[model samples]
Target: MYQGIYGSSKKHESDLDHVINRAFKSGVEKIINTAGTHQETIQALELCSKYENLYTTCGYHPTRCNELNESNEDEILKQMIDLCEKNAEKIVAIGEFGLDYERTQFCGIDQQKRYFEFQLKHLISLKKPLFLHNRASSQDLYDILYKYRDEIKAGGVIHSFDGTLDEALQFIQLGYFIGLNGCSMKIQNNLDVIKQIPLNKILVETDAPWCGIKQSHASYSHMNTQFTSELVKKEKWIAGKMVKDRNEPCTIIQICEVIHSIRDKKESFDELCETIYLNTKHLFFSDQ
Candidate 1:
């Protein structure tokens, strides 16, 4: 996902399969590769289907909404929906969709809203959870998601959440789950926000190669581990390897550790990890 816009140039193959295996070896039961465009969703689903432990979400990210031009918008959308309909068994969620005010240069706010609502309206028929995104647009995202709350009865996840406690509470109130990554632990206030989240309402992710925890963070020592030799050799591998500070799925354990350290003392460490893991499974792989 660290690739350039569209990720169309990413031609590496069978690489993610290795990553999936490594994640499983490291005690990760399942992983979801979210899509931001037609090619990405297709590629993600295809890759996910190869591993029982892997799943993918299908939808347009707000920044990439413009990838569908006005002339071919309807047709392209139908194509995406048809793809989803044809492969609903492999697709776990409807997004990586929502407002992103931070990227107004990539797509106008109005355009983002248009496609976001469109996806939300159609997500009802897909009968899957949502993989939501919101960067400096929680109010708008919440307003829109609220309108489709009934349709999104399967619940949703606010992935890579770095929002305020109030934003987290609002989403939790709606029965949505929060996805935290190392990035969320970057700021003191963000760590404080995490402390307020209930164990059962939270999930952890690496947002790999992007949201890896800072080495300077106190929890790194206990949570950090060397990347597997097999993973370290693969150029297109997931998570950080020994060479550099890339985010890897295995690092999720670190996110868990960091969270566990700062979280409310409502649950023991084991209980907290189990609860978050089950929350993720129930939300994304309930059908399984």
Candidate 2:
């Protein structure tokens, strides 16, 4: 990935591969890498093409709305569609696309809306499930997806969902699975909302190098992993083989642990993990 917000410097090329290998060793079977801009989409495609277990999505993020206007829309859409179509077996989804009213100042609401609608419309022809990111624009995002629900043959996932129970339920009604990451489950309310969601509709992700557990409602004292809180020195932490303060794929297990803490007592720990793993596979890998 690019090393900065301006996207100037680049990180080590093999960094993602190293992290992914560490994650797979820690019981992670598959990963869905997100590509929200033209550059990101290209990087994701290259990585997915190299690793069988790594899947990727191709679309422009709402934050990058300014990056896509009438000038580059046609070229961007064609590149995304062409890569997805040719590598349909590995380039599994089309998203990281949605609304973000929070950052409307950066890119106007109208422009973001237009860009979002364009991706949705074009993706329909590709027949891929969407990997969406919605922040404070649920209603608009929902309306757009609802309008094209029939055309979306593979359905989609609301990744790193931090919406209300009602919003979650609304997406459920539309037949999309809700994705949960560390930040998504940081608060007690997050846990409460997740409790309301059926296990069948649950999907867990790392959102890595970003969404590690900020704070769990209950103490992680009982966490079964050796990478405990003691290792998390305010800014730096180590889990499995990957070492960094930023979230990494290996820590996905902690996301599952957090979910288990708030889950109903009816199921055993292993059973719950199996259920969620299968649900994720069903959402992102069922077609493959």
lDDT of 1 by residue, 165-222 (tens): 9999999998899998876777677887888888889988888756766668544543
* Residue pair clashes in candidate 1: 209-247, 239-247, 239-248, 240-246, 240-247, 240-248
lDDT (C-alpha) at residue 185 in model 2: 71
Worst 10 residues of 2 by lDDT: 2-11
Q: Given candidate 2, what's the lDDT at residue 142?
A: 97
What digit string (tens of lDDT, one per residue) describes model 2 on residues 1-288? 313121453323334555677778877778888887878878877877778788878888898889987888899788877887788887778878899998887788899999999989987887778899898999999999999888887888999999999999999899999998876876667778987888788888888878766544342432456454434332232333344355677787777776776775557878888998888777777855
Q: For candidate 1, give the lDDT of residue 149.
A: 78
User: TM-score of model 2 relative to the true fold?
Assistant: 0.88
Worst 10 residues of 1 by lDDT: 2-11
Please give the TM-score that candidate 1 achieves against the real structure. Answer: 0.86
Clashing residue pairs for model 2: none
Q: What is the lDDT of residue 254 in candidate 2?
A: 78
